[model samples]
Target: MPHPILETTDLTVRFGGHVAVDHITCNFNAGELTAIVGPNGAGKTTYFNLISGQIPVSEGRVKLNGTDITRMSVAQRTHRGIGRAFQLTNLFPNLSVLENIRLVVQSKAGRGFNILSMADSHAELTGPAYEILERIRMTDQADQVVSELSHGDQRKLEVALLIALDPLVYMFDEPTAGMSVDEAPVVLDLIAELKTRKDRAILLVEHKMDVIRTLADRIIVLHNGALAADGDPAEVMASDVVQEAYMGRDLEEALANV
Candidate 1:
């Protein structure tokens, strides 16, 4: 088996006297998709922050490919191959879809800040940028302003930007947070395709059980700032602790339909 691309040892996060995340340990292996699900305030996103360097760990360590990165800055982690798509849309609304992605490609190449001067002249960036657009099925909307695209397309664009970074581990915080039913599948399919790569590790914090059921190879359940269950999706879903803490009776109902 391949080594874990990301791992945490007794990871914890504290806010004042409150513990948002307790001493939790988990490993995310390459070529796998792991879903982290829990009730609200279960420290799901907090755990992602601790690993992504959005927030510091109160105790414990985050390791990427066996290297301790507990103190790495967000930018440093990004360069070290940790990429994230936030629960909220984070994109330049004013820029065109192509421009938004090109900037990331350029940044990844270590170019200086020259958005205006480089926008028209950077053919090197355009090739890879357009390739990403094509992969995301947004090539037709390349020149369209990001604000003008539908919310679902914008979300897909966000993932595309992450693909441009080509990180070893991808952390998605509710990639389908606020989308209509039709829009939800578009983003879901994009995520599904990522799972086929078999060369990257994907960790997602999702509330939607159907999405989790369909995409997750493994599931990690969190409750009240601690690890509740971690195992195969079927086994984890059947767990009484998970059913009582979060799924309640709906899990059985949902599984029956599946």
Candidate 2:
């Protein structure tokens, strides 16, 4: 309803003859946590790739804050206040938790003029890194090398690192991937905390229905590369079309149970 932070119009992506994403349009509002959910091969990830400029659009436009950025490079998008994390955690395994975050903060500080200067000595960057870790409740592990951290701790650290970028919109592709059931909660908690902040928009591509229901202010369901359902979680989850597409016979039964 309000001015959208990110939006797509007739967004489509194709690889050769196969259409991975059809002409679909959606908007992610600022300060909202929106989940894009669908069965496997539903073009969820492809849509993310399209919006983040990881791949060129076959046809369509992606607008960030009313500016056309469909053709922008990944770096351009990041500098324009878009940040993304993969299903697999991306981090420098050998670096200490604080160092990894400090690197991102420093890079974003626009001080390439001092590239070779002692990064650790840059209190401006390190100060924010610790503040970010503390926000995610990972401050205690700030000095630990990433390689020694548990799978759950690493996931939290990855989120901590992303927060240091201070992007207006963040795209998280399966942030809970590769974690044990117990570990998944750590990632979920971090995401939950992020949703409370009103400074940015967050889009998540996730299969975990429970997590989706918990975090999404809105939910978009994709089916075979097209927009299937878009609305509140209860409405979308109750739709017969979405049920049949994703839950099949079990879905109808699930609705009845509900």
Candidate 3:
């Protein structure tokens, strides 16, 4: 088998006295979308934090394409081809949508922001930014301030920013959390479009079963911060632990704690 693009070997993290993610060892390959699912506080997001360098690892190591990166900072990890979009909207509320994406493209191109001379000298930057916006179908809103966009549009823009980076691994935490039913599909479609790339590995943490069923090529379940099941989506979703720990009374109790 091909080496996994992203690998977590006995990956673990703790919050002071609490062990949030308990020794998870897994590998994610290119050309696959793996959905991470668990009840609240099951360490799904915490595990993401470990892989993306958002938090320190209490133990174990995170590797990208076989190179250990447990000590890398968040920016370093992004530079190494890991892009994550969070559950909340993370944007420059004051900047126009085009500017937001252009900044990323420019940064990726190694032309650090030129705040003093902002006279469109970088056609190379805007050209790709416009293409990203067009890919997400946000062409009409390119000039709008990010603060003025609806939650759904902002979510789409976040995905566009991730695309602008063109990371080898794409991580999303509930990409459609706040959108109206009608608006969620647009983001899902964008994700589905990314899934077609043979060089990309996608990791998603979502509670929505419909979204999981729709996009996940594989499913890995986390329970009490450990791997409960990992396999085909249909089989994993139907497994005993997922049925009991995630959907049964245990899940209700877990949700209450969260």
Candidate 4:
């Protein structure tokens, strides 16, 4: 088995008196897909923030390929090979899809503040960024302005931008949020394909159970800032505490049918 790409040991995050994420520990292995699911306010996003360096950890540590990075800044983490996509669709509305990916590649190349310079000066980064777009099957839409693309295509472009960073572990916070059923699978498929790469691991914080069931090798359930269940999809799905706290009756019924 390959070494885990990301590991959290007693990771905790506090806000004032509220503990948004308790001492939770989990591992994300390379070439594997892990899903983190929970009810609203269960601190799933908070946990992502800690791992991605969007916020500081009050206790515990986040390790990427065995190096502790609990105190790293977001930019530092990104450079250390941690890429991310948000729950909200994040893209420059005025820029074309190709331009958006180019920007990400340039940023990851440590040239984010060179508006006056030629973007082609970093052809190495831009070339790989274009390749990422092709991987997500968005090359045809590369020249289209972000605002003009469909919601599904925009989500694909968003992931493409992250792919351009070539991170070891990618954190996606509800990549399908606010999309119709028809639109959500487009983003989910993008994630699934990314997981197939042996060098990349995915930490997915998502709500769609059907989508989760299809993609997750392991599932981590969070409730009230603590881990409620952590195991294979079948085991986590059968957990009564998870069923009640977040899975709800629909998931229970779906589990029964399965």
Give each model a TM-score: 0.91, 0.89, 0.92, 0.87
Clashing pairs in 4: none
Worst 10 residues of 2 by lDDT: 249-258
Writing each residue's lDDT as its tens digit, candidate 2 over 191-224 gives 7877788768999887766777688888888989
State each model's CA lDDT, in order.
0.86, 0.83, 0.87, 0.82
Error of 4 at 79 (Å): 0.9
What stretches of model 4 exceed 4 Å from their correct place?
A: 111-117, 180-183, 247-258
lDDT measured at residue 208 in model 1 versus the true structure, 0 to 100: 77
Q: Can you give the lDDT of residue 127 in candidate 2?
A: 93
Q: Compared with the true structure, what per-residue lDDT tens digits does model 1 show for residues 15-133?
A: 99999999999999988999987777899889989999999889999999999999999988988889998888899999999999988898798875665674678799899999988
Question: The CA-based lDDT of model 3 is what?
Answer: 0.87
Model 2 Cα RMSD, 1 decimal: 3.0
lDDT of 2: 0.83
Pick the winner on TM-score between candidates 1 and 3: 3
How does residue 158 of candidate 2 score in lDDT? 74
Q: Residue 230 of candidate 4: its Cα lDDT?
A: 88
Best by TM-score: 3
Candidate 2: residue pairs that collide: none
